[model samples]
Target: MTALPIHPDQRTPSDTSVPVSESFVSIQGEGKLTGVPSWFLRLAGCNLRCRWCDTPYASWEPESVSRPVDELCEEMRATGLRHAVLTGGEPMIFPQLLPLTERLHRMGVHITIETAGTVTRPGVRCHLMSLSPKLANSTPVGDPRDPSGKWAERHEHRRLNFASLNELIAGSPDRQIKFVVTGPDDLPEIESVLARVDGWKPDDIILMPEGVTVPDPDEVAWVVEACRTRGWRYGDRLHIRLFGDTKGT
Candidate 1:
């Protein structure tokens, strides 16, 4: 039930230019479109810092080259792939995505935006809105990599945006909400989120195990059983299972 801070300047025209972390063709790892061949465009920058986040390079110490919409479209065209995934850091934070998704649509690519559902941009086009709302388990803490602990408070403050989650679900033709579960203890928080989102069905919910290269077998089994009991779907990190945590799949 956390509310996002008001930032009127959050959606400005300058956001049309994005910091490109990395782009590559890979198999869809999680959610409904698992196993689908997709061209991934990983953008930099995010509002929340999940403690179990797999891609720290894109969040904690983000480094990337700024690329224009047209340039990114051309890169996807070169891949000759039909499916395109706009992932992050947090893709919705950038307003440039409106143009990026529009251009990709014209190229006849099916777009899937992988997001934490903390921000919403109505103008952006998306085929599948893959919403992975952060649970309490994602609360950040001090680490050697980030000694200041600045991200801890910031992450807790912005992790959940019920308004954005509803808007994204209402607008998209298809949507899948995934939750990275640390253990059985996270179930109540997931239920609370589900209770807030009207019209969410069991089929629309997916549970994934937390980990980078490989999900712990015990955790996966526990989640699988939980999914069975709740009638929700279990999602596997296919890319990780196949290629470990290697970059670019």
Candidate 2:
């Protein structure tokens, strides 16, 4: 990660590389800077496979084709929005995202990233980072070629990235930690993970209820109280509330 100095006059490069699914301008629907107008750069790839993921369209499937970094920056510029959010199945899956983020920052756009926190890239000064680590309950799609024991071993290796990422975020001031809480069945595991990440503070950690398909008030209440009792924050599923699991909003 080169520490490229951000300058307003930096020219958009002519090189056409990297893939982008779509870029749109919309108010951030979740996390610390909620309701803020932000140009969303939805990159198209992910390493972790969460069972309750809503963006399966952007996960493994080939969506709309790739566009160069400069062209994507141009689309964000056209939005006339000063803030941008780079989100995806996992934005950090691509290192090119760091350069793109640097270019956007040079253009004077405040950048935020909503990621699964299983991957990290250098040189991106995220104004805010929302990191959600995948838990054991969310298993990757199993391949028959690999035995169950082998699958478990591989899964542990992949999921360890989340812990490394969480460690990095512990000292980052602009970063927030979030976990998708499903049920009481998941609470003990969530607590264990939280205990492992010593950097996570109660105020900086949030619990977001899973299953946006239907609003689960019971789960929501449980999360709210757990946050309250534990001195953590409770994050609302704003997009679900706004559009009810609709895509491309």
Candidate 3:
């Protein structure tokens, strides 16, 4: 598979065009608002490439239909669901999101923007900002597709942006800081991240296991114990458990 070029800078409203991978209605699978009925709009494109990325189709190649702001709003309105989630390879990279979210809010829809927390848009509005910052574990190794370790270096440099994370946390009315835990080794990294952010309660943090389908039982147990000990929350990939790794959930 061929990976597409990365667009790290924020786009403009006049150039408010978005590449949409897919959109569907599904229960909130992870983070603070789990089990809530919601509509997901998965936008295409991302800057960093994680080793265990689940949505490679949406990120690696990023082949998607160019949808205008009005068309996207129409789809969201047609869903007739009050809860809507704007997810992506990274949604904030597109300036079109600002207007799209504004429309959703006007329709009285509660919006959740899921992101890697490496980018932020001040004008974008979201009821909940689900921030999942990538860690060292995300660095891709020697894969035949990217043997030059380019993705590894890029992922490392661009994975964590404390400025963006802080802004998203402060801007959103409700927020959750989710960290993908691959194993016990990643615990310290999580703590390091927590130390950087101020004014966050234990309940605001969520630890999720890194897996495509259902999380491993052993990993879940360890994460549960860690969450219990730290007074944080444990997140399960509910969509993976319920609908497997298939798209359009």
- Name the top TM-score candidate: 3
lDDT of each: 0.84, 0.70, 0.83
lDDT of 2 by residue, 193-243 (tens): 777776666787887777766466764787778888989888876666777
Compute each candidate's TM-score over C-alphas: 0.91, 0.84, 0.91
Clash totals for all models, in order? 1, 0, 0
TM-score of candidate 3 against the unseen true structure: 0.91
Estimate candidate 2's alpha-carbon lDDT, on a 0 to 1 scale. 0.70
Encode model 3's per-residue lDDT on 167-194: one tens digit a residue. 7787778888898888889999899988
Question: lDDT, candidate 1, residue 82?
Answer: 93
